[model samples]
Target: MESVVLDEIDLSLIHALTIDGRAPFSRIAAVLGVSDQTVARRYRRLRRADVIRVVGRLDARRLGHVVWALRLRVAPGSANAVARALAKRPDTSYVQLASGGTEVLCGTEASSEHDHAQLLEQLTETRPVLAISAQCVLHVFRGGPAAWPALTTALDPGQAARLDPYPGVAPSEVVLDDGDRALLDALSVDGRAAHATIAHATGWHESTVRRRIDALRSAGALFVDVDIDERLLGVHANTLLLMSVAPAALSSVGEALAEHEQVAFAGATTGATNLVASLMCADVYALYDYLTDRLAAIPAISSIETVPIVRTIKRGSIFGG
Candidate 1:
């Protein structure tokens, strides 16, 4: 890894985009008090460095899908191989090699009982995979751009309002039609893609494209996530926290962790350890402080296990779609 310098302006730009990934450069410039060209230049620099990406994703729950986190003990020297294979699958996301490169951790989504069974069967039958444990994510407390407090804090209320996309009401049991799927496929590739471009791809009028996008957003069927390389944010440590909490206090502890700025995401899961959290910190010392001061305050927590992620093989997405 090489040293990267990010000034306050860069941070502000990132924060603004996290609020709205497709925000106009002029809008961002006005908020940050910089020229649009400067913001554009900085965006290009960051993109070239692979330090950040803006991606659109379908809400798994709305799509009738359930998410699973898998912990795998792989055969020696087979960890990277197995990880790459898993990464190539559209269902798996956030694949990483951990635990001395012999353990693989990743998330995948299953739409049905058959889908879930096939996934388990595929991995268990694989020769390189020795043991596996899969935890079904029951509910997401906080995740995606909406939960990144550090980025949002750079702007005051007024500035944030200027960049806000003003998404609409959440929908219940909103199933995806073919047109919806086509539109989502376009967005999954590039969250910031122009309306005209998406229209061309989906064979719909630009106005229709915009309308569908707004509808999906309002219905809570989609989200725009700005994926920043935490390393570039001076946060070099990303750890998975598996926690066991008293069943009665599960919601309390999970909600508390979700509010912590250091927490990238937290969820309640099905397993012996019912709560799972992904945390990012400036360094090991910062992570220790978070665990001791913030996490220790949660009296319901009975146990915690931490694992450092060595590499991100694939961002959770559909298998090679």
Candidate 2:
């Protein structure tokens, strides 16, 4: 596929959306000093090219669900099939073929111990499976509800401030009722879907829809994220780093890694390798530089395993039909 060339306006628009996925075209235009029609047209063209999308995702942890990162070493020649199957499952996201197409890495949400067990059983029974390691995410230093800084750097501070949404409310326990589910279902498909459209789908008034969405965001129960093809930004290497860090320095190392511009996601997890990070780099050489210079500078890292992702089948979870 031909890579889409993003101009300055396109980059700024993407950065604006990352700040507020549902920001009106007029508002984004004002920030970028472009006409509303131009902003809307560029967005449509990008969407049509499958270069970018906005999705609303629920933070399962707020609802008492466990999020897991799974690494499955499958039989040769089966990674693609396995990844596609995993991507089709609604619970899985960031499904990818990695480690020379013999391994599949994905993130899943399990609502209960039984659900987690059932997923493990299913994977163990699948013919292509060879080995599996499931790591529960203990804490997320970055990623998931956080925009990638590399992508968002196009906008100047003033422009970003204008586009920034209000701060989220304090974290609190959130329970999902049927109405919330319906509203989230519509958002999963299009985070920028109009409130009136969502209300019609959910059988609620537009005002109610707006109120519910605001409440969800403020409570940290939901977030709108930008999903973009990295190739559009000249990213050619996507690698996952699994590291064993000194127990005493884990927090510092994780925090430091989260600040790196090349890192798209970094988190502490429960497993042999306590810290995991996903990197988007310009090329393999860039990745090498990161490993040798940036990563090597961190004395806390004892060992590292680099898995170059071959492809990403899905970027985020989508709820409902």
Candidate 3:
């Protein structure tokens, strides 16, 4: 695919969508000081070019699902096949070939005990699999529903405020039904889908669809996220940092990493490494600087293992093109 050259308007539009993926074009236009037609056209062009995609994702924690980060070491020359197979599973997301094509890293959401056991069984039985490690996400300091600051910085505070729709507190004891599942299926494909379109897919009235979605968002069970090609933002290097931190300073270190612009995702997990973070940089040199400078400044880190991602096969349950 050819690269899409983005100007200020394009960048601002992306920022606006990141703030509220389902925000009406007219509302975005008002904040951007452009016509509704211009905003719509720009979005269409970007979507067609695969520059940006809006997807609705269910919050596993809010839904009482367990999220696991998996690292699989495979025999030489089997990384791509292993990664692709993992990506095909509905429960897996963020599947990537990393560590010089010797390992596969991915995240999976298990909704039940059976699902969790099944995943482990499948991984253990897969041929050529040398080793496997699974980490249960204990706490998420950032990532998931949180938008990365790299694209969000294009909009000033005032503009961002105008585009932001206040998210109300989650209701206690939320649950999902068949209708909700159907609605989410449609939204996972196009978060910006019109109410009528979603209604058609879910066999619900448009008003019901709207109310259900609003309720889900309010309960923090559903969130809309913007997925873009990082290369378009000049991100040439992606690495995962697995660090063993002092247990006493784990929260502090994870919070500090979340504040870094280069850090896309940071969290605390149960594994050999207590802290795991994903970094996106302009180049390998920038990554090295972050490692030796910013990261080294933190005294809590006892050990660091850098895994450079070779290819990302999936993102947030959606396969990458």
Candidate 4:
């Protein structure tokens, strides 16, 4: 895809949504000092171009789901087919082809141990798969709705405060009932779906639909995210870093990496290499500088392996072309 140049207002609009994906256009316009129609028009253009998408996702941990970061080495000719198959699963997200298209890396959420084991068994039985490794996430330092700062240009604190729709409290654990699941399913498709549409789908009153969604957002059990092709936003490279960090510095290193603007996702995982991070860079040379300068500055890292993302098959709940 050709890159699109973004002006201050364009970037501000994206930043505003990153702060709150479901914020009213009028509210965003007020924050960015533009007409509501302009904000709405630009958003429509971006969405239509596949430059940006808004989606609501459930916190897997709160839902009692085991999240796995899986890597698969497949036969040369089967990478695309295998990746598309994995993308179709309801539990998977961030599926991508990496290592010059010989491997696949993705995140999958399983409802239970049995479900996780079953998925692995199915993959292992596939004829094209040569080997696979699964790493269970122990701690998430960044990712999802909360990690939307990669495209951030600038926004005043006051504008941010006004834009935050769910500001009553920090997220808390909440159990989901059947109605909640129905609501979430709708949101997974479109976070900005109207309450009326959601009500119809869930067989509940519009007011009931609104109330349940509010509760979920307030509890931090669910949050909305905007998915934009980083290339369109001037980010030309993305890499996954597998790093071995000293046991005692795990938390500090993870937290520190989480603070970097290039880091789209960072986490501690159960594996030989304990730290995993996803970074977006301007290009390969920028990535090289980041690894040699920024990453090398970290005292705790003992070793590192970098895998450049060749293509993203899916992100959030939406599949890519």
Candidate 5:
């Protein structure tokens, strides 16, 4: 797919959403100082362009499912079909063809690496694929640098760069030696840096410069991404399906629901409600119909609590703990 580039106003609308998706068009209009109709027109355009999607964030770990990053090597001419197939799976969300050929980045609800492998095995029985590399996420960090700033911001020195470029992974930019530290401190305030500048200023061996950066990433700490526009906190309405289960069925059932893309956070808590989930989505109507039909297909559920999130106070340990 081609990239959708937004103009300045479009970017502003995104930032406003990052702050609060439910933000009324009247309110957004006030902030952006545009008429409500203008806001509406632009929003429709953004959606049509596919540059922004409002989605719900499910706490999968809480829900009893594991999330994984998938890299797939596909047969020639099969990338689109494979992606379309994976996209249909409730267990699979977020398929991207990355810089690598036929690579796909997806989030799933698998509690462990073994669980994901089993899922792949089951999937292969139906749709055979070439190769798959998977990474289990340890955590997801959220809410850093405030949208536009986050998009443009580099990691501040000594501060762990907020927002893991890779989900559930830590930033790699934090480990700067004294010399690298000095140079990075300069670049933190400014991204553009000349080689002589980094070298002369930091007093490091110039030959080892790029190597240091490689060490940071190879160590699993550093990543950089283009800044994201602020989220007004986009809305993906979710159904909270609750269950009555025998003690033995509690863990596995909760785990299964959590892996569903529409199911967000899942857990077995004390109450008439044995399980809970926060489903993430963009199209509320589809999600609503999906829950009533598809999730209802799962007999374990007896009750469901559906809610739409209005705002996020904070996200992840990415915030100062």
Candidate 6:
């Protein structure tokens, strides 16, 4: 279960896995000063309990994918039909039924502005759709999976210790073939590599390369040809707001935060800072002070742990080391 509760050690284990799904249990145990068996047992329990899942987080935009969030209002009795139809497209990455209810979100990848329009058209053409609105996938928050309290202060030392943990992966995982591996390696170096150049380097026909790329996209293993320049795009500043909210204030606080355009991602986890958010801002000062003022304004707020990003480790194309 979803109902399974996580202690500090469990949270730490989660942090480790989130960073690198393939991290070995032994390595995790070493990092946590626990036995490998302890790490394995805890992780197995988490897996069986459906607490955490290990999945690849590839850069979709790097593969030339422009992510968008489509809100679909389907005709009565056609919700399932509409969802099924939308799910079939390779461009679609995430689908959700928003809290207000029947509006289904189809988060997907698009080749370009034209492709996004075509995707919206396709959604409308589907029999069940009554109306559809698509919001571009502006940003993805690489943060804790769920609501986590103030791991920096509120949670027990053992719990907070796992706030920034590590883990490893096993062999026989989703191993990449030569062609795909080479492509990824190249893109890792230069995400904007030209198609003809890539084909020349790989000695594959241009069409063959294209097909393989298509296959990767359909499989949800790769994202090609995405154009996202956050700095130039005016979403230059980023902040990780670590919050400590009283249980009574969580509803209002969470909803209010979620409604803000600045909030890129939100998660509820098992720590003192019950809610964490990734926010984009206009500038360094704004990012810094926005969270400061918001947290101070909340009466139920106990403390705030805001981590302004120093170096962007990896984004659509930018990478640190």
Stretches off by above 4 angstroms in model 5 are 1-5, 62-64, 98-103, 111-118, 141-321
Residue runs of model 4 more than 4 Å from their true location after superposition? 1-3, 317-321
Worst 10 residues of 3 by lDDT: 312-321
Evaluate model 5: give its TM-score: 0.41
How many backbone collisions does model 3 have? Answer: 0
Model with the higher lDDT, candidate 1 or 4: 4
RMSD per model, one decimal: 2.7, 2.5, 2.4, 2.4, 20.4, 15.1
Of the candidates numbered 5 and 6, which has the greater lDDT value?
6
Candidate 3 collision pairs: none
Q: Count the backbone clashes (under 3 Å) in each candidate.
A: 6, 0, 0, 0, 29, 25
Q: Which lDDT tens digits does candidate 2 get at residues 24-139? A: 99999999999999999999989988888898888776788888999999999999999999988867857988857799998988878899999999999999999999998877
- In model 2, what are the clashing residue pairs, if there are any? none
**lDDT, model 1:** 0.81
lDDT of 4 by residue, 1-321 (tens): 435677788888888887888888999999899899999998888877777888888777666666789999999989999999998987787789996767988788877899889999999999999999999888888775555466665687888888888676877788888777788888877888999999999999998998888888888778787788888757878888999999999999999998888888888888889999988899999999999998989989999999888888887622110
Winner on TM-score (2 vs 4):
4
lDDT of 1 by residue, 92-161 (tens): 7578888697899988878787998999999999999999998888888777435467666777888888
TM-score result, candidate 6: 0.48
Model 3 whole-model lDDT (C-alpha atoms)? 0.85
Model 6, C-alpha of 222: deviation from truth (Å): 8.0
lDDT for each residue of candidate 5 in 1-321, tens digit (9 for 90 to 100): 235566666766665654444356777777676899998898777666544454323234333455554546776666666767776664554444433344443445564668777877865664436776554443332222222232222222222222222235443324334565565444432223444566777777666655664454344432221222123224345233335667676666666664554443454554545554445555668776777786777775656655343322112211100
Model 6: lDDT to the true structure: 0.53
State TM-scores per candidate: 0.91, 0.94, 0.94, 0.95, 0.41, 0.48
Error of 6 at 258 (Å): 11
